[model samples]
Target: MRRYETIFIASPTLTDEQAEELVKHFEGIIAEQNGELLKTEKWGRKKLAYEVQKFSEGYYTLFDMNAGPTLIAELERRFRNHDSVIKYMSVRMDEQTKAAERQKVRYEREGRRKAQAGIKERSLEEVMG
Candidate 1:
């Protein structure tokens, strides 16, 4: 599995209940595909940089997940088929980026452990003493 980020814009005309249903629809897809959804952020109704589908604003939703390529393809296909979806994008995060994130967590964890253990780096004289 690889980490992926997807941001999609839905038609602003949708009612709150309709919008929630749309969000749940996609979330269900991820679950059905055996993918893990890391995060879902709804940035409701923002002005578009430019008009799309003759609409000046859209309801934005972002998804972060760990999934295989097939899930991404399926999600994109579904997005394209849905009339309410005005725009969508999916990007796969590189392993280097993932590794760096893990490395940062590992470093912080080690630092906390060292602090708890009362272990600190010392100069040669301090070590000898």
Candidate 2:
């Protein structure tokens, strides 16, 4: 029951409803396969680094779940054979997920430091005197 994250791009030409349906279809597959879907996110339309099937932008969706290897195989197979899918990537998270979580927290703290760097901090003497 390792955690897995999958991100897939759907064609930009699809209507909003169509895109939702596609996401739901994959979710259904996971449920049917007894995979626990932890999170699903639709990133909306975004520009691609390169053209995919003559489209410059596509809708992105992410799925985070815990499941066996079989579910991943089926998901990839569907993406490969489906016309709507422009690109997809899946990664099995081992202990690497914890490292990523720690990195994310550090990144946020660094961002806050950068944003507030211009502000002066109060010294102990300034507070007491």
Candidate 3:
């Protein structure tokens, strides 16, 4: 399985319940195809950068998951056939990006440790003086 991120915009004209159902529908597809869904975010209705499918606003949803190429292909095919989906995009998180993220987290953790140690040392120096 490979890390993947997918974002889709749904028609804003849908009722809240309808929108939620639509989200669940796609999430179900991922599970059925053996995909691991790490996160799901429903970023409520927002104005689009430009008109799409004759609509100026849309409900945005994001999916972070791990799945193979066949799963991705099927997911995209579903999106293309779904009328409620105004637009969608899927991206595979490459190995280089994952390594860089790990390195960044490591660096941040080290920096925090150093800062805490410095603070403790400063407080000790003041008390001793």
Q: Give the alpha-carbon lDDT of every model.
A: 0.94, 0.94, 0.95
- Per-residue C-alpha lDDT of model 1 across residues 30-81, encoded as one tens digit per residue: 9999999999999888999999999999999999999999999999999999
**Model 2, stretches more than 4 Å misplaced?**
98-129
Deviation in Å, model 3, residue 37 alpha carbon = 0.2
Local lDDT at 45 for model 1: 82
Candidate 1 overall Cα lDDT vs. reference? 0.94
Q: Which has the better TM-score: candidate 1, or candidate 3?
A: 3
29-115, model 2: which lDDT tens digit per residue?
Answer: 999999999999999999999998899999999999998899999999999999999999999886697899999999888878967
Q: Against the hidden reference, what TM-scores do the models get?
A: 0.74, 0.74, 0.75
Question: How does model 3 fare in lDDT?
Answer: 0.95
Error of 3 at 75 (Å): 0.5
Cα RMSD of all models vs. native, in order, equals 7.3, 8.0, 6.3
* Residues 1-129 of candidate 3: C-alpha lDDT, one tens digit per residue: 899999999999999999999999999999999999999999999999999989999999999999999999999999999999999999988776988999999988887998988844357768899
